[model samples]
Target: MTSIIVFYLLYLLSLCLGLACVVCVCVWSGHWRGGFAWDGSALEFNWHPVLMVTGLVVVYGVGAVVYRIPLTWGQNKLPWKLLHAALMLIALILSIVGLCAVFDYHNINKISNVYSLHSWIGITATAVFAMQWVCGAAGFLLPCSPVTLRKVLKPVHVWLGGIILLLSIAACISGINEKLFFALKGNATGTQPYSSLPPEAVLGNTLGVLIVAFGLVVLKILSNHEWQRPDSRPEGLAYTPLLQEENE
Candidate 1:
């Protein structure tokens, strides 16, 4: 009972933090960064941060916890699998769009691409996420795959999901700091530097903190063995449709 209560509390906290992260990024970009546009301007670049948080952080985080939710334990696994896949697909599409927006903006401004640590980590995380989704679908969703293979890959998939989320958070934090530095360096003569705790600086730092909190809560939920979906198989293995079908 205590575990269940703790799980729900953590879940609620994660949701709030995730939402705050998204809203913070949007407000920071839209209000302070001159709003959004698609005309290959700085405005267009703002969409990159907004979409990345929405997709990589919020959407992907939700998908990761779906399988572990106690409320969904008695339900059909196939539907949850499909829902997870759909969420991942959405995340992938949004990430691709975010990358395009930044790349296009850089090209238009004659700026170099993928030169920063933030860019390198972000790109790698996205690529790995895309591959994870594809391979997961093939291994778990496909009816013809060997059951042994699915069981072997399950742990790897879960491990990589957590790693990708951490990587995304790191990339976002670095990106936030990098942007603040740029803002401080480009400020007018009388403008306050980042060290002065400017509004934008405060908001960006808050977003980074919120994202990290959200990721930690999510990882907590996922790692708690007590919160995982109940396994009814004789050996206490997770419930999988293919395995059941083959056994029957």
Candidate 2:
């Protein structure tokens, strides 16, 4: 029961990260990109942006780990260990690639091709992430469940997360192979694909990037809260908190 509750909260947190990033970027874009064109120059490395991205990454990675850790103070193994592990690993990879994509565009102006890979990874990751949640909800009888429904829980979880993970890989491949934003004259001195992310995909990928990063930060905070009693989780997280806990 406790594990089930924790998983739901984790899902909420993941979603929060995604939606928050969308809002942040939309707000930032409105302010930052006015009439200004990306000039292939490196980002100025402002503290807030760095903190926002890094904090989210750490939070996400740790949460990923926590979701899959196989034991939760009982003799039995943690339920859905594989699903959690796979999802977390995928999230970590996507987050790293997202940072890379940011650099590729903001610094090298070599992102059209790079964005392909980044986009695929992100979509695939998100797909997998979403599936994980669905299976989890159904399996846990989340919100509420019938006794018979519980019988299919394990299979539902395994299958759903797995499908999402597989799709993410496909998305990853397709993303890296982008052909839509091919070469174009730079509006700001040398920015290729000056289109600033295709209108169709911009909302999805940009928001995905920011949200994943933000989610990581939130998880990291939960993991590192020192006042909470320390548990048997990992100790080396960048923003290590003793235990992963949440309510509702």
Candidate 3:
């Protein structure tokens, strides 16, 4: 029972932190960064941050924890698996759109692309996430996948989920710092520098902290063995071998 309670508390905290990070990024980009547009302008670039936070971070994190939720233990695993796959698909699409938006903005403004540490990490994270999603869907969701194949892929999938999330968080932090450095040091009149702790800088910094906190909490919950779903099938449910092996 204590384990159950701890699971709930950690899950709720992670959810709240993820949501807060989304909100912070939206406000930082939409309210402070001249709002959003789609005409290959800086405004269009704002979509990159907002969608990345909403889809890649928040939605992806929620999907990762779907299987860990105690409330869903009594239900069939197939539905949960479908939900997880659906969420991942959505996240991938959103992240791709975010990437496109930034690339479009850069191209229109004649700026170089993929030249910074932030771009390298962010692109690599997104590519890895896409590959992970594709591999998971092919291995787990397909009817032709043999049981042995799933047994092999499950552990790899689980391990990669956490690693991809960490990569995303690192990318977010680096991107935030890179953007702040540019925004703060720009010759925009009346705008205070990062050293001045301006409102925009404060909000951007807070968004980075929220993203990190959310990732850490989710990772902690994922790593807690006491909170893992039990091997025993719930009452009235057909037997399932989802957790038959610890490595899986």
Candidate 4:
């Protein structure tokens, strides 16, 4: 619980910082109405806007994934039924890719419109995730959770998640492939830099990292892998809470 709070706090704090940077950029861009610096360079130095938004969004996405464990560990756990899991899983993937896209700006010329590709992927993934969220929200509410709705949400949720996961992986792979191609061209620098990269790109990169982290954690929990099994569960026994509770 302490750890969860820390991660969430970090995510929120980072976001606030990002917002501040965005404002700084906007202010710098507009200059003073009364008498502004005629120098046409305020916007250029304000790369923090890009950095803050991208970095913090990624952090937040990661926090979502990170926080899931505490969520599941509670007394009356919120069951992320397979269908609901799809919603979270897709959101994480989109978030990761969105971050990666932004970070790809420096490499855009090398990768050729990675920003566009990422944008499309992010938008599509967000749409599917939003749908999943609505359905999942309904599922959580007793009255709103209609059988027909579950039927409708379940299959669609899986389909959307599956596509988003596969495509997001593809997009991440593409970014790496682009870098590899660059390396092959004899430009050996691994990190790409761009003069005009927007705050959105950083937002995308940060998001990508965080979501990847979150996804791994969630998947690990879902598997209930050997590492996470409770002490009471006989060596190889799975965690069937009722059986354990009854025994206790």
Best by lDDT: 1
Rank list by TM-score: 1, 3, 4, 2
Task: Give, for candidate 1, the lowest lDDT window spanning 10 residues.
Answer: 239-248
Question: On a 0 to 100 scale, what is the lDDT of residue 159 in model 2?
Answer: 49
What is the total number of backbone clashes in candidate 2? 21
Q: Relative to the true structure, how large is the alpha-carbon lDDT of every model?
A: 0.86, 0.43, 0.84, 0.40
lDDT of 1 by residue, 1-248 (tens): 88988998998898889889988999999988889999999999999999898898889998888777778776667677778889989988998899999999999999999999999999999999999998898888777767688888989999999999999998889988998888766366454688888888899999999999999999999998899777656553353543343221
* Candidate 4 deviant stretches above 4 angstroms: 1-119, 139-142, 182-184, 187-248
Best by TM-score: 1
Candidate 2 per-residue lDDT, tens place, 1-248, comes to 56556655665665576556545544443443332233444332122233323222433344444543323433222343444455454554544444454554555643344245555555455545655655554445243554455554645654444444334334433432332233233456454453656442454356446544544444443443332223443332212211222211
lDDT of 1 at 176: 89
Q: Model 4, 93: alpha-carbon shift in Å?
A: 10
Model 1, global lDDT: 0.86
Q: Can you write out model 3's per-residue Cα lDDT over 83-105, one digit (the tens) per residue?
A: 88899889889999999999999
**Whole-model lDDT, model 3:** 0.84
Q: TM-score of each candidate?
A: 0.93, 0.32, 0.92, 0.36
Which one wins by lDDT: 3 or 4?
Answer: 3
Candidate 1: C-alpha RMSD after superposition: 2.4
Model 4 agreement with the true structure over 1-248: per-residue lDDT tens digits: 56557544544554454344345334432431112221233232223223322322333233334323343443332243333344355544545444444445335334434255644654465555556556655553344454565555645654554454444434443443332333233235433443233343343344345444433443333333332213333433222321123231
Q: Judge candidate 2 against the unseen true structure and give its global Cα lDDT, from 0 to 1.
A: 0.43
